[model samples]
Target: MKKIEDDIRKIEEEISETKIILPYGVMSITLFDLEQYEKIIVNINREREKNQNLEFRKSLIKKYKFVFLSKKRKLNKILNNLKNNKVEFVPKIESVVNKEYLQKFHTYREDISLKENSRYFLRQRINCCINKVNEELFLLNFHPSLYMNSMDEYIGGDFRYRYDAEAIIYEDVNILQSESHHFAIYTNEKTKEKTKRDILNILAYLNGTPIFLFTQNPSFNRKIDDLYQQFDLLDMLRLRKNEYFKEETEESISLQLPILKNYNNYSVVLFKTLKHAEIVDLYHSSLKQFEPLPRCVFLYRVFEYAASVDYKVKIRPTEYKQEDAIEYYIEKAIGYNPNPLYYMDFGSRKVTNYFTKLKLEARKIFKEWSEHPYKKSKTRGEIIYNIGRNLVAHGGNGEHNMKYDYDKNYKHINDVNIILELIARYVIELLNPGLKNVVERRKIYYEKQYTL
Candidate 1:
């Protein structure tokens, strides 16, 4: 009976030491926390080294024909304690020495395999979620809050103004951050109609009466087919290695006469010849002699022209007094030169005179509001207007210019738009006072046009 018991103990010992056969390429089936698993891998490596040493020692012992006993039983007990303590297994095994011991080992190994597969699946799902969140954040970053708020005003309300808009998308490719916004103003149908009407009115006022005949053929008449043929012939000749021949051939050719197209059908004359072609060409050449002129130069010229008109039409006695009052102011605002020939000779100077006259006319109308005691108290528009004028005249830091620092007060489109609105309002008041009803009829129009 003791011999049978000893045999059973030996079987149990061998079973405990044996490794269970797992799925193909499967090395381990032990379930452990991250730290525990790391420790198990380390132990496995150490045991493998120790086993090699033991095998070498066994070889020496076998050569001497000496009996040897292993301390494996003690090591197995320690390994069992490591596995069993603070660790639980699912699909539990009954005994290590049973006939069904290998089957039980397979069950535990399958459980560990499934657990590992589940961990991998969960990690992938979490990663997918993170990627989706990042994509949404990237898209949202492009649509800035400020742009959306501005767009809301135009998109909503009775205006229902849905015009074509272009946005330049600027972003950091590395960090996925948007940086800038730029927009272009386009003429809508309403704006186009208003511009046409204004142009016709100005033309009528300038030419004594509204001449519908000029509107019929507003643009310069030119035969497109003749121009095309001339261009093609010139291009073909340009490729030839004979400049003398090309010049001689060009001189001999006669261009077809282009019939003038009448623009009488349109309500407004869309084109004008302010200066004769020869004079315009001379003016262009004079402008090219200087660096590009500032916007104020153009504004100054407009003002000069309006002043000239005031000189011609002495209709408004108030305008005459205003003109005398503002003449010195305009001259001082811009340094005056007395050479009439120099003014006439310089195209940029002439353009400057025209723009300045227009601005002065706009300002004169705005100043009329100051006649009322209540209007005089409101200084916001007046202060901004003065700042804008100074900015245009001097090319300084605008309202932001200070002793210690420069501030760009008009940092946004809305701020600049407000200044333009005030200027336009003043212009309308001066040009068409009867349109005061048209201007005052809509409170929302002023808000939409100028709010910052």
Candidate 2:
């Protein structure tokens, strides 16, 4: 009876050891935490280097490789969730080899003839939540007394409103008496960047008016709080490529209903034809500036836009191509010395005299350019671009004889300011000729009214 008990005790010890003999040698499976798996692999590698037995190495590889591969797949599953930023419960490394993962590894390790077919299925169901969110968000850009005929019209996906439910006229935050109208665009885009881009594109169409301020409010649902946003004036100004002037009030332009309505139609055509839409926004915004420096920069942009399209403007490496284009356009379209009254007329003597002075000073500046290396002819382009535009744009660090000083060059830039506006208007008309007749009639009407 004592001998039988000893035999049973020896059998139990053998079972606990889990020793198996292969063609190479004896191997044992040690029950340890998953953290020790790396040490086991290292030991195997160290032993492999010492043992030159080919069959021994093959046996070790066949036995351990299957278990290593299974554990690696399970570990990757946990890592993938973390990589994708998903919150999930992960098993501790100590518990992995002692628990569920260990059982799977043991099943594969123990069964040398085990045939496992791993089939993985990954499915994604995209939720179409368009209807659940606000389908359209509208940005209302406000400007003072736009003089647009009261008309609520939908143009393609973008909607324009003079007075409507969505386009409510808001009182100017700074000025009490001054009320402002808006050109609103409705789109499904929710991101702030996309909304701003859409607003800019629509504002490009309203080049006839000055749009400096805007507000965005999107309501996804009534139950939740809405997001209200406004683009800060300083932030928008900072985005400008060249320096710009900021004024409290916009210098509003008055146009008849038919003329203003045609702006809508002409904008549609311009959107398709105008390759560089940024120049359009820059041109119109320059008109409302209190200072002249920004206007001069915009005037140069006008010439650049003209130069890009008109092949007749001879391109020279040393010469300013924009200035050349400006000269070419003025001479071809409205003569070198264009009368201010031909484009717009003011009832006030002071305003009228200011414009008259602008034209005379332009001629004087033209003569000054004769001494320049290029010696450009006495044209509107010569004074506006080569002289005024260059002085403000290039004059930095108090250089160019301190020409960048606003007070110092006020007279020169102010004169350039008036001429540039007219030139900008002329170029715009030249490019978008659809509203040319209407503009001409309005100019004639203003001229007659001022004369009377």
Candidate 3:
């Protein structure tokens, strides 16, 4: 058997010692009142779908008032229930060493409030997916109810929506080597989609830093919730070198995933399951010129290379291999340090082909965005922290000193990592155009919501 991770052991110890308490003093789940809580949950979820008013939803929060007892305090009651034939009982193995895995089921809680109950379905789906992967779960996360996070960071641009999702993170000491560590992160749908990408960036965080190992792909199986594999940087760059050589269309049933549409009261079971398939297609198609990477990934890479040259941060490739060919290729693919041989063999061609396409596509994207009526340039107040408030140029253009928002012009430059993220499917959708089938299918399920 694999050795239990030490951090996980400590966390399990803490959980066992502390009696859990939900927000707003909603009594803990230590004891069941001999009622099927699932039925109550179903009813609550139903009302949430039908209702839309924010106040009404807030009012529903105070409904759960059941008193709960600790496992030890409730043990005699459980035995009495079994004695009276109210329930079936099983004997506990007192001699066995106590640990979380030793327990039959590990129940975790998210927000006990009614406001975000819809996410429970998403969590259930993620849980189901994890169960399929067969890895021993180490830690699980649930949402916090009643209290929205007190985030003090600056909010510059308006978002489509801001939401934080609850997820489970598994800690493994060393799946590959004695020195290396591994962690698996699983979220309930939208949690993976952060509204505002920060300066610190997503990849830098998910690289298994602070807690565990390096992340390559950070992508999961759409059909089955498997651990995200590291994106093969070398392989992806080589594809770039080859002008995005793509494999022939090989659609299979396993690629299909049922999409959730809130119109069906947010049902995951799709009547037509090709929504994910077509999305997978569109996402891949957008990156065909770059290969095995997303549109944003290629866009960022191109931007990085271009800026590196302009700002003189760029290092020209040279041939200096400390070891063998494979190791050399791996280093070259990482693109941190470069040599002339790398450029001649791969970089020169990739850069040329990539820049050519990027120039054309970026122009079109800019034109469309500039012409859109409802579109507001989300660049205002972006440089609020700048000494000049907004960067200013005292050229005295027409009359007074000209106001130049240098930050807006240098948005990507100001933030070196503007859109870094795990190459997950939900993330892919955020970058790619929606496929026709997926778009059309969305109409049936996005029933107009009356609820907030």
* Top-TM-score structure, candidate number: 2
What is the TM-score of candidate 1?
Answer: 0.18
Clashes of each: 30, 0, 16
Better of 1 and 2 by TM-score: 2
lDDT tens digits, residues 215-271, model 3?
343342221112122222223223222222344632111111112222122111112
**TM-scores, all models, native as reference:** 0.18, 0.37, 0.23
Highest lDDT model number: 2
User: Which 10-residue window in model 2 sums to the lowest lDDT?
Assistant: 117-126
Per-candidate Cα lDDT values, in order, are: 0.28, 0.37, 0.25
> Considering TM-score, which of the candidate structures 2 and 3 is the better prediction for this target?
2
lDDT of 2 at 441: 32
Task: Give each prediction's root-mean-square deviation over alpha carbons.
Answer: 33.3, 27.7, 22.8
Q: TM-score for model 3?
A: 0.23
Better of 1 and 3 by TM-score: 3
